[model samples]
Target: MGLPKRDQQYHTYADYLGWPESVRYELLDGVAFMMAGSDLAHQDIVGEVFAQLRNALQGKPCRPFVAPFDVRLPKPRQSDEQTDTVVQPDVMVVCDPAKIDRRGIRGAPDLIVEVLSPSTAGHDQVLKRRAYERAGVQEFWLVHPTDRVVTIYTLGQDGYGKPEIQELVGTTPVGVLENVEITWDELVARLPKIEY
Candidate 1:
């Protein structure tokens, strides 16, 4: 199915909190973006990665959260219902306790992960990259299940810096998150083969 049309109006996290769960969306630069669902392989990949991150983060100060969790970016002086924009990142880690809110995360997360699908590949690479950068997210990971590759992008002064691509040939270190590493083979083993 296609995404919802642009409403030509900007919204905040509070506005999104009132939205129905049927409408999947992400807010970027004051615009609402409908996030498309992914295929089985895509979801499996994300689940595997999320599981790994969760297991590894045990005992650490960081906490891992899966999608469908609202991540709100609030505009200045805006009420929760007025300027709060809620997004569901595939995976995220919140290191700061203060940013956690009853509505969701109100600021940039320590790490954000997006599993790429055909329709969203470009948006994740470019559009979402810019948005996450502008939001000051420390790390972003783009997972391409078809290619059996994962690209880790860390936030830099200008924007998201060059990505480190790890092919599914062997163990690949996730350089962005400290003390965390995973292999392409490990990630690939979690998903069924793509028939197409």
Candidate 2:
């Protein structure tokens, strides 16, 4: 039904970068994993959230970016032989211009968002969440299409403590971002829908 799990090895960001545009991938624990692509519904959800962030942050210091963008968080041990992992989040908000490199966003992004798909559920909810928190990402949002809701994780000095889960039924109160407030109803209703 699906590909078997293998111990995929990667050397550097260059190695991962050399991959063709046909596939999406990520490096975890110094290993390369082939992640499945998202369906139409997932893309729609991501686009909706992306639009909200874009609209809200307009004329503001913060800028929103969609992925296929690489984010590299350096580790303590710096050796040429050591593999540096690079990740492409579904969406991200970066307030720091220094982190925005020619290649991709390089340091801690203010907000990281992942639109969940069946194949990436475990990684998004667990591994990536832990990594983003460890990197000092201020916020993390995971949008689920099937459940029709979004869960947000905010980082604290201690750690990524917990998430503020919001159930989106018809209309709900979305969180405040960069001093701007938007409702869940407006987001869902205005989200660009795919024409069948």
Candidate 3:
């Protein structure tokens, strides 16, 4: 069953915590958007990215996480209730240990990776993109599973500059982490071809 339409209502992290655990949501500017389950190919891609990051970042202070992880994005000086935005990117890395807690991340992560799904592509590219920019996330990557491409956005002095898009080939370097690289050749061998 679909969730009730609450587009006209505003929500927050406190409200989010009280909701039934069975349901999942991503809040954008206090508006609740229920999340959908990812498909096989999507999961395959996500798994590969996370696995690569895990091995590459070993012995490093930064840690990587997969989705279903709550990332609370509060505005400046906002408390739990006052904070209205949260999301679960497919893969993320938190270099600053202070930002992580038992619940999840309390602040912006140094890097985030979102594998684009057809239904939520626009939300990831536009709404969440702007939110990440505002939260001061240093880097964001949009991975298109079916399209076999990745678009990277690095936050600069004036917000995110023009994105750099790359075809899924060769090795893609992690901008925020030094000596860490994602091997596309191996990922391609494992990823199933997903149609757009």
| Top candidate when judged by lDDT against the true structure | 3
Estimate, for each residue in 28-112, the C-alpha lDDT of model 2 and write its tens digit: 5566666667778777667776787789889988888988787886566643235365678888889878888787877678888
Q: Which candidate ranks first by TM-score, i.e. highest? A: 3
Evaluation by TM-score, superior candidate among 1 and 2:
1
Model 3: which ten-residue window has the lowest total lDDT? 1-10
Output the better candidate (1/2) by lDDT.
Answer: 1
Tens digits of per-residue lDDT, candidate 3, 72-138, equal: 9999999967889988888999988988988999889999998888787888899899999999999
TM-score of model 3 (CA atoms): 0.93
Per-residue CA lDDT of candidate 1, range 1-196, in tens?
A: 2345358788766566667878788876667888887788877777877788888889988888998887775556655566534568898999898988776787789888898887888777887777677778888888887887778887788777777887766655555557776545755775655563
Q: State the displacement of the C-alpha of residue 46, model 2, in Å, after optimal TM-score superposition.
A: 0.9
Candidate 2 C-alpha error for residue 159, in Å: 0.8
Of 2 and 3, which scores higher on lDDT? Answer: 3
Candidate 3 lDDT for residue 11: 91
Displacement of the residue 87 alpha carbon in candidate 1, Å:
2.0
**Arrange candidates by TM-score, highest first: which order?**
3, 1, 2
Error of 1 at 150 (Å): 1.4
